[model samples]
Target: ADGAAYERALERHAGLAKPPGSLGRLEDLGARLAAIAGRCPPPIPSSPAVVVAAADHGVHAQGVSDWPQEVTAAMVETVAAGGAAVNAIARTVGARVEVVDVGTLRLGPVPGGVHDERVRSGTRDLAVEPAMTIEECRAAIGAGARVAAELIDGGADLLVTGEVGIGNTTASAALIAAFTGAEPAEVTGKGANLDHERTPHKVEIVRTALARHAADTSVEARGSLGTLASLGGLEHAALVGVMLAGAAARIPVIVDGVITGAAALAAVALCPDVAGYLIAGHTSAEPGGRSLPDRLGEPALLDLRLRLGEGTGALLAVPLVQAAARVLTDMVTLADVTKTA
Candidate 1:
């Protein structure tokens, strides 16, 4: 792919565009992706779709969240009701949000427009057994990817990955430990505004969960994605599917927070080349989220210290990406840049 040459060409192309650097990083991003796609100018993003995968975690019974286990179902309703944080942000960017019940329990008629993509009622108790069966993990991942395929087919030019399962951070912490060699405490964070002091103890608890799950002999053969399925919340699994689907389809995906970052890690582990299609939307205020972009070798597009995980951060990032895409397609050449310069 002439990786080095493509990068160089992108820089030259960006400089040749009108206004020199008025558009900032967006201009750089557009040019870079254009070269990667072997296009002088790339398509602009008008219809971006953000998929929110929600589920309840078995580990929540262990007291990992400040919010109740029931909040999973409640928040799913909020998203469907169009009153959640993500809904507001998606509205701002005019990106559609779809909620998928990847593996939640206590399910009934899911809210209208919510996809009943459940692979299981819920995962097994990770403290006592593997969280999910290998088949269930694969099914959940497939569900997410399939949802992404539908959205992309619906004329979406970009995809943003988000999730809504509580306690998933515990799984993310464990995955981060395995992938980044960071201790659980190093990667764990205070989810949903728990006491700042309790965050450290929360990390220790996840460390314990990882240790408890280590007895599962099938995990190693299961791959990182499988390992996450063994401990990850349903939304995490769906995000992994979304990441893989978006990468395979070559749609740029904006990652929201540490949870999404963890999913990206697992997705890349499943397909090492998937990282090429990812954009770290913002550094999450989640305990170990700040470390994610560096883990992926990319800088975040925003840093307002966001911690909400329902794709809010990623949806907020759409305007910037759109601006970037616009730069490639609409910006003029240096010859027409400006006489003021």
Candidate 2:
């Protein structure tokens, strides 16, 4: 992203026919698009792609979510078949949905149409032990980076983060708590509609994980890899990779919900510059969703109280992102207005 282009965009927005700042955040978004494109009028993203990284969590054994772990692989298959919510939403925005079995637990061949980049069958239970070894965490991150590179090489101008994994939110909460120093109760939420009775247990699970991995979460600890390996799911690690790759390529990476938000924090921890390329697609209904964006220092593009992950919220925000760029390219300048007058 070019600082000069961003300043140029701000000047261009002021010279547009509309009153100064009338477009509000849309104007800000347009300027950001310009910076990412390194031009005053950024090209409207024509090939937005959502990479839905699917995995399972051994934390499901702790009964943190209402949905069973098998639902993770099942949802991956549904995503591959184009029957999931993300696929329908992607169609509306003319975006492509790519499902990656980054750590899904399946004994057979990978689902058709899904990319095979499994770091492991699934993550170990975080409440009892580290979710992934450092090597496993790095491998998942590499898988995510590879996927992002392939999509970009294939002409995806914008990248959206998505994930599917039962009990993953527990891991998300743990990661958020680890990175942000937020308490378990503050970051934890009922995942997959888990009953109120179980929500408390979910919070406790996050607390236990954080307590067990206190050394890894310390500010003076080696780096984010330890914290992530201790509390993040494989999909979470993979999404971190995607964000880093997109940032390295100087493209926008739209993040979805709380789960991806945790990954974004991990990514920023690994590479602070990665924060510059992130766009929060939406803030979900979850409590952590509200704080995640604040931690990222990026306000979400939408707030529909949506909690469903699957990249649906981010997909819905794609058209809005395109519109932001279109505003710069399509709207008439005040000079044009004067000429017509």
Candidate 3:
């Protein structure tokens, strides 16, 4: 990304026919697009693609979420068949949807639309063991990077991160609490809008995971990768890979809700510059979702109390991102207005 291009975009915004700052954050968003694309008026992001990475968490056995782990595979099938909310939203937004089986525990026969690169059946029980070995974590990250590169090379101008795993929110909360030092109670939320009756148990699950991985919490000692390997879900690790690869490719990556937020924390921890490459699509109702923007220094574009994680929130914000870039390129300049006058 070109720092000079960003400055030039700000100048161009001031010269637009509309009153200065009329577009509010849209103007800033346009400038960021310019910086990322290295153009005064960045190309309107087209060929948008959303990757829904599916996996299972061994911690589901802890009774944190009422949703059975089998639902993860079922939802992956739903996504492949275009029956899910994300598929409908992606269709409406003219974005392509691809399901990636990174570490699903019991996926059935995969559809042609699904990408199969499973690192393992699913992650080990974080409550009892490390979610994955460091080697397994590296494999999942590598798989995510490869997927991102393939998508970009296949003409995807914009990318959105998504996920599907029945107990992922529990894993997401645990990862957030571990990295951010937020209490488990502070980060855990009503995942899948499950009954609040189980919230206490959920918090305790996260608390247990944190205690088990205590040595990995020291940033100087264990580092972000260690924290991620110790606490993150396979989907979360893969999302971090997608984010890092997107930044490397200089393509903007829109982050979804809490699951994606946990991934972004790990990604930024790995490479701080990746923060500049991210755009928060929406803040999930979950606590981590709300605090995520504060952690990344990038405010979300929307907040409609969305907690569905299959990239639905992020896909909804795609048109807004496109509009920002379009306005920069299509709107007339003050010089033109003065001439017409």
Q: What residue pairs clash in candidate 2, if any at all?
A: none
Instruction: lDDT winner between 1 and 2, please give it.
Output: 2
lDDT of 3 by residue, 64-144 (tens): 788778888889989999999999999999999988999887736666778987999888888877898888888888888
lDDT of 3 at 278: 88
- Against the reference, the lDDT scores of all candidates come to 0.78, 0.89, 0.87
Candidate 2 least-lDDT 10 residues: 214-223
Estimate, for each residue in 202-250, the C-alpha lDDT of model 2 and write its tens digit: 9998988887887455443347888899899999999998998898887
- Error in Å for residue 268 of model 2: 0.8
Best by lDDT: 2
Query: Mind sharing the TM-score for model 2?
Result: 0.96
Give candidates' CA RMSD values in order.
Answer: 2.4, 1.8, 1.8
Cα TM-score per model: 0.92, 0.96, 0.96
For model 2, give the RMSD to the true fold.
1.8
TM-score-best of 1 and 3: 3
Clashes of each: 2, 0, 0
